[model samples]
Structures are given as C-alpha cells and as structure tokens.
Target: MRILLVGAGLSGAVIGRTLAQAGHDCHVIDSRDHAGGNCHTERDAATGVMMHVYGPHIFHTDDAEVWDYVNRFADFLPFQNRVKTTSRGAVYSLPVNLLTINQFFRRTLRPDEARAFLECQADTSIADPQNFEEQALRFVGPDLYEAFFKGYTEKQWGCDPRNLPASILRRLPVRFNYDDNYFFHRFQGMPREGYTAMIRAILDHPGIATDLNTPYDPAMAGQYDHVFWSGPLDGFFGYRLGRLGYRTLDFERFDYDGDYQGCAVMNYGDREVPYTRITEHKHFSPWETHERSVCYREFSRAAGPDDIPYYPIRLVREKALLEDYVRLAQATPGVTFVGRLGTYRYLDMDVTIREALDTGRDFLARAAQGRSPAAFVHAPL
Candidate 1:
C-alpha cells in the first residue's frame, strides 16, 4: 500500500510512521518548511534556547501509552503548567482554584464556601446554556466570569462569548481545592531537546519519505493507495463548502534581562488590553538558565485567508459548514481526515497525538481486513 500524508505535523508523522512500519510506502508532505506543524521547535540561533515556534506546547497527558510513546522519540523533562491571570488591576492564580478564589475575593472561603459562593454568583435562569458567555455565567457567575473568562475568551475567539459555543468552555477546569497545576494529567513535561527533535525522530522510519513545503493535491492524492489528511478539511475539497472559521494568534516578541511576567503564561483579563496573554519562553524550560529572557504578547484574531488557523471556531454557522465538509469527507473515498483541522476542533497536543495514534491503528486494522477506515475517530460536534 502507498500512503500519502497531507501534513507533516504530529498526526501526519505518526500516521506515516505507523503505515511505513507495516511495509507500506509512506510519503509525507507539509506546506511549511518544517515538519512539526505548529508544534515545531528549534534552538534560538544566538541564545541556544529551545524556541517553540508556534507557542509553548507543554506535553501533558495521563495516558501511560501516549507518554511512553512520545518519550521514545525524545527525552522529556517533567514540567507542570502553573498559569496566572491579571484582572481588575490585580494578579491571581488561574484555573479558578481555591487560593485564586480566596485571594481574588479577599476572603478566606473554605472549599465548600468557595464552591457555594461561586454558585451564588451564577445565573440560575439559563438552564441550557448555548454560547460561551451563558455557559460561563451559569458555571462561575458574573464576577468571576467577567474577571477571568470574558475578556480573555473574547480576545482568544475574536468575538463576544455569546457568539461562541458552550463546548469550548468545557475544557476549562474549575476546582474548589488550592491545587493550581494547570493540567490535571499525571504526566506533564516539555521535550528536553525540543518538539522538532522529537518529531524528526518519529519520522525517522526507513519507509517514510518527507517533503516539507509541498502541498498535496488531487493529482498527487491518487499516486498513493490511501491518504491520511491532517490539513484543513475544507482545503481537501478546495473550499466547495466554504472556509471554516478559525482563530489565529499574532505574537509580538520582546527581550528582557530577567523575569517578565514571573510565570510562563499570564492572561490579560481586561477588555482594555489588546493581547490575550503574555508568555515568557524562558520560563517554559526552567532546567536551563539564561540572562536574557524572551517574552511574546499573544494577540488572537479571526484567521484570515493566508494565516495559519489555530482554534476552530465551531460556532453555529461554522458547525453547519463543518457538517457539509464531513459529508464530503465521508463521500470522498480512500481518504481519512484526522487531527484538529481535519476534524475541525480545538485540541490539546496530547489529545491530538492520542487520536492520531488511534487513527493509525484503525487504518492499519482496516487495511489488513480490506476495508475503509472510519471518517473520524470521534464524531464532529
């Protein structure tokens, strides 16, 4: 079998490696000059610091298999994400932990009291919350929602929360305890070398041939027995169903001698602030020390034609557009759409890798039995 992978990101690399290992000839192509897609990382030319090209992607996952698989490619240093947000002229711990609650409200509320207080602030009338705003209001209430989520989310999605779907907020963790570890996963770390090194190792299989800055087209699609597309779903059909909505980021870099924000990530939770968050790249790798630090002010906006799509909007209209693309995907034989853009969803790095692995396994299973792989591992919602 000849397999053609449409993108050289985690999904494409993993899928290609899996098929190639099974004696299939795999050809991987990516539009970017690099292999790791948005997760691509490289050492800063002058500083020798590992720079996360797209942004800081901390690999955090509870799945033992996923963690072990990733570790096989590159050494991973144990790192937990501790995030903070500045709102209403004050800085507070994030993920709505007990300490953040107590400190933000200026009251030492117990676990139960804090939970109850949050409920008191919620809008009880919204039984079935539809949009992001309503969902936040129902879950955390007006004060906390406005303080932490409203402005940041608006900037992130490039729209009022009312325009976005409720599912987006479901990823946010709300805890009553003082635990401030951003992710609840058991394994949390960044690659010791960098993500690009890990990806290069993953695609090191003998049967896989990589072509960066090459876009796969219909003429090229038929050259392979099967295709595992990790690019935008609409791009496969040439946007016959119209382009899906996405939120992309614009980073403004700054140099500092010492600590800038005192943390890796800091959300600017006021509407007045233009950027959503500021990331101190040096803090992401605390194992090494550098006198000069680098920070980026992350501005989120609606993805334009030439911009790289980041977060899937998945708004009502976008969902309708996505359904059309999914229908086309299902009808279009010999191709399986996987990963964030292919499935049209916002996914963490761990989840994307997990799903890609699952997709690879399913693809091989289907090929062995002479069947078509399912259009998706999980349903598009």
Candidate 2:
C-alpha cells in the first residue's frame, strides 16, 4: 500500500513510520520546512540557547505507553512546570494555589479557612455559567477572576471572556495545596535533544520519505492507496464552510544576562498589558546553563490567512462551521483526518502521538482484511 501522510508533525510521523515498517511505502509532506510542526525546536546560532520556534511545548502525559514510546526516540529529563503570574504590581504562584491565595489576600489563611473563604467569595448567582467570565466568577469571584483570568483569557482568545465558552476556562484549576506543578500528568519531562530530534527519529525509517516545504493537493488523492491528513480540516475542503476560528501567536524575542523572568512562563493578567505571557526559553532546559537567557513575549490574536494557528476557538458558531467540514470529510473517501488540526481540538504532543499509533495499528488491521482505512482515525468536530 502507498500511504500519503500529510503534515510531518507527531501524528503524521507516527502513522508514516508505522505503515512503512509494516511494508507499506509511506510519503510524508509538511508545509513547514521542519518536521516537528509546532513542537519544532532548534539551538540559537549566536548563543546556543534552545529555541521553541512556535512556542514552548512541555511534553507531559500520564499514559505510560505514550511516555515510553517517546522516550525510545530521545531521553527525557524530569521537569515540573512551576508557573508564575504578575498583576497590579504583585507576583503570585500560578494555578491559584495555596501560596497564591495567601499572598494575594495578604493573610496566611489555613487550608480550612481558605476553602471557606473561597466558597464565600464565589458568585452563587452564576449557577449555570455560560461563558468564560461567568465561569470564572462562579469558580473564583470577581477580584481573582478579574485579576487572573479575565484579562489573560481575553488576550489569549482575542475576545472578551463573556463571549467565550465556559469550557475554555474549565482546564484551569484553583488548587487547595501549595504544589504548583501546573499539570496533573504522571509523566512530565523535557526531551534532552529537543522535540525536533525526537520527531526526526520517529520518521527515520528507510521506507518513509519526508518532503519538507511540500503542500498537499486534492488532485494527488488518486495517486496514493491511502492518505493520513493532519492539516486543518477546513483547509482540506478549501474553507467551504468558512475557516474555523483559530488563535495564533506572535513571539517577540529578547536576550538578557542571567534569568529574564525567573521562570519558564509568566502571565501578565492585567488588561492594560498587551502581551499575555512571557516565556523564558532557557528555563525549559534546566540541564544546560547559559549566562545569557533568551525570552519571548507572546501576543495572541485571531489567526489570519498566513499566520500559524495555535489554539482552536470552539465557540457555537465555529462548532457549526466545523460540523459542515466534518460532513464533507465523511463524504470524501481515501483520506483520514488525524491530530489537532484535523480533529479541530487542542492536543498535547503525547496525546497526538498516542492517537497516531492507535490510528496506524487500526489502519494496518483494516488493510490486512482488505478494507479501506477510515476517513478519520478519531472523530472530527
């Protein structure tokens, strides 16, 4: 079987490698010049500092199979992301932990008192929260919500929190403990050689051919026995239902001697501020020490035609638009939509790889029985 894998990201790479190893000729293509997609990393030519070109991606997952699978390609050093935030000229621990609560209120409340106080603070009227702002108010209260989430959420999504869905704020947690590990994933680490090396290893099979800076054409569908697409679902159909909502980021780079932000990520939650988060890339690689640190101030906005899409805005309107694309995808045969862009949801690198592995295995199983691979490995929209 000749397999055409679109987008050389983790999903595409995993699928291509799996099919190739199964004695199928696999051809992988990516619009970007690199293989890792948004997870691509490289060393700065001048300072030798490691750089995450699209943004910082910390590989963390609880799935043992996914963790071990990635470790086979590159060594991963244990890393716990301790995030921080600044608002109204004050700095606080992120994820709204015990330390943050104590510092923000200027009182050392015990765990019991803190819990009671928060319950009192939360808005009871917002029983059925509709949007991000309402959800924040119900979960945390006006002061904290305004200081921590309102502005930051608006900046991140390029819209008012009231207009955004409640689901967007659901991922954020208000911890009762002092632990500030950021993620609850069992396995959390940074790849020793960066993500690019890990992806390159995944697609290094002799039977897999990767063509960087190559675009996928609908006309080429007849040339391949099967296709695994990781590109934008709407893009596959030429945006017939209009481009689904996406948030893109712009990174402004800077260099400073010693630590810049004293942490990997620092959120500025004040509405007056333009950029949402400041990422000190040097902090990501704790193993290597550089006297001069490199940083990026991230500005999030609606994704334009030429911009790289980062976050998906799964609002009501976009969901409807996505449904139209999914219907079209179901009708279109010989192509399988996989990964974040194809499925129209945000996914960590670990989940993407795990799904790709499962997709590839299923594809091989279907082929062995003389059946066409699915139009979607996982449900889209």
Q: For model 2, what is the C-alpha lDDT against the true structure?
A: 0.90
Query: Which portions of model 1 miss their true places by more than 4 Å?
Result: none
Model 1 clash pairs?
A: none
lDDT of each: 0.87, 0.90
lDDT of candidate 2 over 139-177, digit per residue (tens): 888989988998888888877788988887899998988
- The positional error of residue 152 in candidate 2, measured at the CA in angstroms, is 0.4
lDDT of 1 by residue, 99-136 (tens): 98898788999999988998898899999999888999
Candidate 2 regions with alpha-carbon error over 4 angstroms: none
